[model samples]
Each structure stands twice: as structure tokens, then as C-alpha cells.
Target: MASKRPQSPPISLVELRKRCRDASLSEQELTDYFLPDEENSKPFAPALKLNEALVDVGRARPGPDAISKLYADATRAQTPLPKKPRVLTQTFRRAAKTKLLAEGDSWFNLPDYIYPKTAIDFLGSDNDFDVSNIALWGDELEAMVRAKQYRQPLRSGLFGHFLFSGGGNDVLGSIPAYVKPRKSGDTDPAHAADYVKATFPQKISQMMGFYRSLANDARDATAGRVVLYVHGYANAIPKKGGHYLGGPFETLGFDPVAHAPLCRAIVAQMVKLFNDALQSFAQSTAHVVYNDLRPAMTERDWYRDEIHPNESGARKIARIFAESVRANTPGV
Candidate 1:
């Protein structure tokens, strides 16, 4: 519904006046200025905050008080573990349509919906992973490969190829359907498993498939080892890190209790999905990865809003993510 990306805080009127006076306005000129800001600006404010938290978290060493402090802080007021209400989650439109998701629908359980608009006037790319490819879809994810089919606006074809055999996709955008509870009246205890079996396996499927497929076309690939990345909140943790990142990250922008807990809950379900995927392979040797953004968000300083980290904070998240992917990629 809302945008995961924050609209750019308005540009300083002084700067605008200066530009207009010198004809420099051309550089900053645009219709519905908010569009450009949303499309191009990086939410570095939170990244910077996380950078500071890295230092705070780094202080905890081998000691009882340190451990106590760490735990105490997690439950405190400023933690980013549970984000505040109604923050928007980002989603790419091309991918949503390609995935054949219904209008006004979402892949996750909550309602801050993921909807990516085409953004005609915007420059650069919607996704960071694939610059060459202008648009993307959930079926294009590299990690969780599986069968696909579409019709008309979506696709009217037979069961097609696996996911992400095509090329790089924004790790955050590639996620398709997450594992949601089967509802109170679910007919079967194995509903999640049966659903995975009967339907086309989603991203989680691609990641947990028997083998890793790094081909050039998604619709023509087989099973593969995927690098699955589950997203947190608007603080949308980065998958890389920077030096002296103040917090455990480079961002400080989420209400952790609202956002972090959801992320953890989502990830926990992901673990279960991985288990189901393992069973599907029969010979099971696929790998999966998960990263949490709560701890750092809890111990950071630039946590101005008790949510998303600052720019430096985001850097910390990215750094940690990069390392985790490197370390645990070979095994589930």
C-alpha cells in the first residue's frame, strides 16, 4: 500500500532558491519531486545510525554483565526488534505481475503491502542486483528455483522452468511467497508440505532444491543452491558492511518491536520451509541462509526513532550479510 522507501525529506528551500537563481534548478527539477526522491535516493539516514550501534554491540565481550546488558537492552524501549506500525514494505511491480499475484495482494502475511510502481521518469534501476535487466519477477530469483506457468496478462503456458536461472535479481525483491500458517481450519497438519508439493515451489523452493543451477535462463534451468535473503522492515537491512559502522549496521530507521519480531517470525517460518524443501529433494543437499537485524538495532545510538538505523547502520548490516552469505552458503 505505502512505499517501503521513504519519500525524500523535502530539499532545503534555500538550496532550491539558489538553484533556481543560477539556473541550477535544472539539476533538481522534476514533476512530483517525490517520485525522483523515492526512485533515486538511498535511505542512508538509517545506515549511519546502525554504524554507531556496531560499536555498542562490539563492546559486549566474555562477561556476565556484558551478557546481561545485551539481553536487558533487547527488551528495552528503543530496540529495533519490533518495528512500529504501518511502515511500508517495498516490492517491485514487474516482478509482482510476472509472478501472477493478484492485484492488491502480497506474498507475506501482513498488510503494509509490497507494491512496486513502474516509475516511468525515474533513472537507474529498481533493483540493485541486475542493472542490465530493466525489469524482474519473483520467478527470476536465483536461489529458490521451481516450475512456472502463466496466461494472458500473466502467461498462458504449461508448467515452465525453475526460478532465478536467468541472472542476478535484487535479493530483497526476489522473494516470492513466504510460509504462512495454514489457517485455523487447515485440513491437514502437512498442509504446508502438500502445498509445496502440489503447487510450483516458490523462492524458498529454488533455494532448497536438490542442487544449484546458475544458468542464463530461469525457464530452462534445473535445481540449484540459492542464496535466499529474508527481509526485515523498512529499515530493510543491507547485505553488506562498512568499517567502524557505529551500530551493528549502517542504518537506524525501524521500530524494532514492530519490525524486527516480524522479520524473525518470518525467518522462523522460512526454516520450516527449508525443511520441507529438503524432503522434496529426497537426496537433500541444498543450502539456505538467514540474517537477523534485531540485535544491532537494539544496541545502537543513532536510533533516533527506535526503528531503522542510520546510513552507517545500514553499512553494518550489509557487511554482516556479506560475511554470513560467504560463510554458510555451502550448507543449509
Candidate 2:
């Protein structure tokens, strides 16, 4: 009989990191073995409490059923009574103070740290302004709108300022195709521009629809008192390519050394396209402000990986956003 094959021991986190650095294991393999299936696959939640809150409200749908039963009972009664005049009294109270509501993807989600602190610290350490974040990891613009997540907090009419960060994932999702290797001697710029021209219109329209709906909802809920702020992404080094996180680009299944330049160029163009679209949308929409963080972010050592910013970077973004809010909103 053949001897039984020896089973390999489980890989520790340390071993995993070492293998990732050595390029001995792919990110997908690591994720499959170490991470929960849901974590690896499900889209991130908008807010910690959003799902629970939705469930709580969902249970209240039976309220109308009770009202219908009451109507049925009233119809069975045959007696009539004289009606009494109703007294009316009016009580007035101050309007609730406005708060900031943030929504978007991982940039605002900040997996490793307390994200709201970045914005809250800049707004005021004393907590003068309330801030709520509903960002999720791996969220696309269309998904958020389709889920109706944007309308949830706005429905309360309590938010006075809106902070949004998105479109990064949309671009990232298309990166593999966007940076696909072309034939030898093909002009990179022309090829990239052609891709952008063909793909960006439909993408931009989808993004615009999200913005328009958000703007219209804010106006309806807050009577146009809410201010919307959107920021552009900073440039990143393509050579790194998610190395810190053991991301797909770590292996890339291609010649990384040869393709690095084209990848970088494609990233730059993608950022520009998204930012230009955001600027144009902001220009056309009322009460919308676009902050071009590219110049500052490009200079700052803020990125933790190819896609995410470290604490320092987050703080800088918060400061810029806070300044914009303070300037536009009358009494900060």
C-alpha cells in the first residue's frame, strides 16, 4: 500500500504576509483560505446600523393591517353619538440643528480606523456638528442608488451637509480591461483615449443620475438647506499595485515590469476622466461643491495601498472638506 500523503499545516498570518511579499501566493488564494466567504464576496454594508435599522422599519409594515381591522370593527357598531367640538392648541419648538451625512465607498468606510473622527476632528473636537457616515467597502455608484441607501438618512430631513466619495471602485472594476496589453508599437495615449471616449459616456450618465437623484432628494428633504461636497482622488504609484494588501495586481498574471508604465498612464487618465465628470456635474447642480484634492494628495504620503489612504491622508482630506463646509455653510 502507498503511504498516506502528509497534510500541510495551516498558514499563520505571519507566514501569509511573508508569502505575499515573496509572490509565492495569490491574493485570491489567501482570501479563500483565511477570510470568511461573506467577507470575501458580499458588498460592504453602508453603515454599521443601516441593515439593522432597515429591518426595524421593515417590521412596521404591518401597522396598516391593524388600522384595517379597526375600520372593520367600527362598521359593526350601530349606535350614533353627538360630536363634541375639538379644541386646538399650538406648541412651538426650535428647529433641530443640522448635521452632516456622509455616503460613499471605502474611502469613507476606512476599514482599519474610525473614519468619522477624521471629519469630526476637523469640524470641531467639541462635537459642535453631528456627523454620520454611511459609506461601505466595494460600493459602486449604481448599486448604492439602486439599493435606495442614499434616500434613507435624507428622508429624516436632519442632515445639513452631504459628503460623498465614489467612482473609484467603478474605475477600479474596469482597470483590468482598461490596462489590457495592446499590440507592439500602438500609441498608448490614443488607445487609452479611445477606450475612455467609448466607455465613459454611459458610465458618466449613470454617475450623473446618482448625483441628480441625491441632489433632488436633499432638496426635497431639507428644503435646499443641505450642501453637497464631492472630492477627486489622488494619484498613486502603479508599480506598487496593491502590493501592501496582496491585491490582484500583485501577480497580475502578466509582465508587471513591462506593463507598469502603461498601467500608470491608464490610472492617471481614469482619474482625470472621473474628476472631470464630477466637476462638470457640480457646475450644473445647485448647492454642490467639488474639491480637487489631486494636487494636495499627489504631494502627500497618504496612501496605504494603491487605492486607500492612510490616517494622515484621511486627516488632510477631512481638513479640506471641513474648510469647504465652513466656508459655504453660514455659521459653522
Candidate 3:
């Protein structure tokens, strides 16, 4: 009997770039794959298009004809009770139920093929909340705010909460650009601040401004009642296991093994800067809650890779979020 060849998994936009690079897929093929759709035509990666559709489902309002019929029925004679009262009551009841609108990076948007689980996946299963997760893999906070893809859903007045998980990609994903190659005769410092590029601080400040804008928008959209829940990443120990992020460190002349301490410090600094900003925002801003995820997933066993947490870890993070929602929000 002949031996069978090993099978490869299906392809998707999440890792299309890697496959294209390895197989030398042509530009025309990519064009054919994503063209004819206006959102997909944007200059960014193709994966964002998928997220845009997933999260930007506009108001599900009745059509003009349906409205006319409903109006006629409500005003018609011989009708003991008008349908308007019942309809309004139902709408109000639904509006009172907790609905969540989420946007962020890979932690909230990891593909099902890789781990079949994410924080949102677990959170959605919780009884108290209904989640509209629009997170995309490799998304940065700057891009998420600039896109304002959640604006439509937010203004629809259907959601009572906004969940955010960002900043990690803004710092960690851009490591190759933000981290500088060490100089000769330079002793390794206790922190990696000296190794980081000057622009990193400016970038973080800009992201904070965007975050404030988003929170204010959510508040204004819902008449100051929208609760924004934001979470920060746990400190991940850098390892050469995942398909993403780690390669760039080595390419920039920073060896994972030789510069292990510096790598750890870089990640630690990134987490601190991000989490601190989130905590400050939570304390200062109205209707905002920050959940520090570090304490929950401090051990290496909590992680599935260098960056993302495993299923058990995601469950713990989800539990933290659910508890916050239960304690803070008025109704489920």
C-alpha cells in the first residue's frame, strides 16, 4: 500500500501574507480575492474587512413599508388596544438588557482555527451579556480609533456597554520598529526604556487621546449611560513558539536567548505603560471600568503562546469581565 501525503489546513486572510510570501502568490490573485467590495479595498490588510462586516451591522430598523403598515394597524378603528404600547414596551425591555460592543486586537479576535477560543468567545457564552465582537487579529489601537467602525452600532442605542482590548499591538506588535538595536560597550540596563525609540511615548500619548475620544463618543451616543470596559494584557514571557511577533526581535539583532532579560523587560515595560494608562482612564473617566489581567494570568502556564493566553486563561479573564459587569451594571 502507498503512504498518504500529509494534508495542510485551509487558508484564510489571517495568515494570507505569510502564505503569499512563501508561495509567491501574485498580486492579481489577491485582487481577485478581495475586490468589488468597497470596505475590502482599503489599503490595510484583508483581515480588517472581515472584522468591519462582523462588527458594523447597522441599525436593524423596520423599512418604510413596514412602518406604514404598523402605523395603519395602530390607528385603525375597532382595535381594542393599539399595538404601539406593546411594541414600545418590548423595545424598552430589550434596550434594558445588557448588550456589549467590542473592538480590539488579537486577544479578542484570535481565529478559531488556532485555538478555537478567545476572551469574547467565553464572554459571549455568559448568560448576562450579548456581545458584538469586531476585533481583528494584528489590529492596533491607533487604527481601531481612526476607523471608528463601531460608531454605527454605538449610535444605534442598542448597546449598554463597550468592551475594549488594545494597546498590546500598538507596542508589542511594533517591536521591530520601536525597539532599537543595542550599541557596542553598552551595559544592559535594569529596564528596556533606554532601548525603546523616542517616538514610543508620543505614540502612547496619541493612543490615550484616541481612547478618551472613543469613551466620550460612547457616553454621548448613549446619553452618558454607556459603560466602557477595558482590559490590559498580562505580562507574557517571550518565547520562540508562536507564528507571530518573536521573529522580529531576532531580526533586529536582539537574540531571545542572549538578550532574554532585555526581552522580558521590554514586555514588562509595555504592559506597565498600557495597563497604567488604562487604570488612569478608568479612575478619571465616567462610566469606565478597567480590569487588570496581570494578576489573573501571571504564570507561564496560563499562556498558549508568547502573546495570547490559553483557553483556561481566557476563561479566567472572561470571569473577571463578567464579575465587573454584574457588579457595576444595573440590569442584565
Of the candidates shown, which would achieve the greatest lDDT relative to the real structure?
Answer: 3
Task: Candidate 3: list runs displaced more than 4 Å.
Answer: 1-97, 183-189, 241-243, 299-305
TM-score of 1: 0.25
Ranking of all predicted structures according to lDDT, beginning with the best and ending with the worst: 3, 2, 1
Write one digit per residue (lDDT tens) for candidate 2, span 166-209. 77665644555444444555435445554344555567667778
TM-score for each predicted model, relative to the true structure: 0.25, 0.62, 0.67
Q: Against the true structure, candidate 1 has what lDDT?
A: 0.28
lDDT, candidates in the order shown = 0.28, 0.54, 0.64
Error (Å) of candidate 3 at residue 40 is 17
lDDT of 1 at 77: 10
| Cα RMSD, model 3 | 13.1
TM-score rank, highest first? 3, 2, 1
